[model samples]
Target: MRDYLFPTEIERLIAAAKKSPRHGVRNNLMILLAYRHGLRISELVDLRLSDIDLQSGRINCRRLKGSTHNIHPLEGDELRLIKRWLRVNSNPHSEFIFVSERGTPITRQSAWRIFKDAGEKAGLEVNVRPHMLKHSCGYYLADKGCDTRLIQEYLGHKNIQNTVRYTQTNAKRFEGLWR
Candidate 1:
């Protein structure tokens, strides 16, 4: 079964990630963007400096699972988080936005570790992983009553079937079912 965090859990995860002093800035940036943009761990790790445009507020996500690359909007607190990390991070010259302590791009395994660490700190029952953040993004958007096709495009899903699960999983949609 696919895993997804509720909106509250998402917030809790963010808080837990933020509470960590070690690599907190970078971890927050990575987790926040993964949720905001529905990015796969590979995409998150592979993102380059040129992929984001702060002025235009756009993220050019390179879809990895047989989907076409697409440009997505960037705004709100997510943008601010990116800016804050960039301002304080020592590796201003690194190609990748999410870098390791050594100033090199973090591997997918390291990205997974970041999410796992946050899950432990957040006291979540489910083991959090990078893809769960992406699923949270999908569920969050779906809960907001976003169109399925739009979510499909936003997520860079080549098949609508893959995106259909979000619609089925939107817990808010079933509110008052028996009432």
Candidate 2:
């Protein structure tokens, strides 16, 4: 909703990805996934190697907070980046989708730190976190005319009201037109 990162913030992340050190590639991929899929930080951390399907351009999300397991589609650059990251970093021993330098699953704290560091390096004015990326995903989808019911399904929102809140109405567009 309004809590989501501004468009400029997304731009900053993209710039950061371009300049990030090689080791930070996984973090960048996580950022993309969070924003693209509207996933909670907990869900992101719980992801496993078996969740993603590059060939089919879909992600299988398990044990979401408010809903059952679901399949989400990937599009465009998000799909491409994920494939690239997987190709470079996939490891048999790692059960997690994202791993740290130690080859262990990245913790929630580490995920937060990665986002914070990336935002700083990208010169973003606002602090971006994993949740904010999820919010951004919802906002963007709503802005693009996605239905609230569909958004609810995609975001795993148990209540339609929660999904409604994510649809940001454009004040400027309605200004002086509505009585």
Which candidate gets the maximum TM-score versus the true structure? 1
Model 1: residue 135 alpha-carbon error in angstroms: 1.4
Q: Put down candidate 2 lDDT per residue, 61-128, tens digits, no spaces.
A: 66466575679887878777766767777464787878776778889998888888888898877777
Instruction: Give lDDT tens digits, candidate 1, residues 4-102.
Output: 898888888988989878778788888888998899999999999899899998999999979878999887777888888888876889988988778
Question: Which candidate ranks first by lDDT, i.e. highest?
Answer: 1
Model 2 TM-score, 2 decimals: 0.85
In order, candidate lDDTs are 0.88, 0.76
Flag regions of model 1 displaced more than 4 Å.
171-179
Worst 10 residues of 2 by lDDT: 167-176
Segments of candidate 2 deviating more than 4 angstroms: 90-92, 171-179
Please list all clashing residue pairs in model 1, or write none if there are none: none
**TM per prediction:** 0.91, 0.85
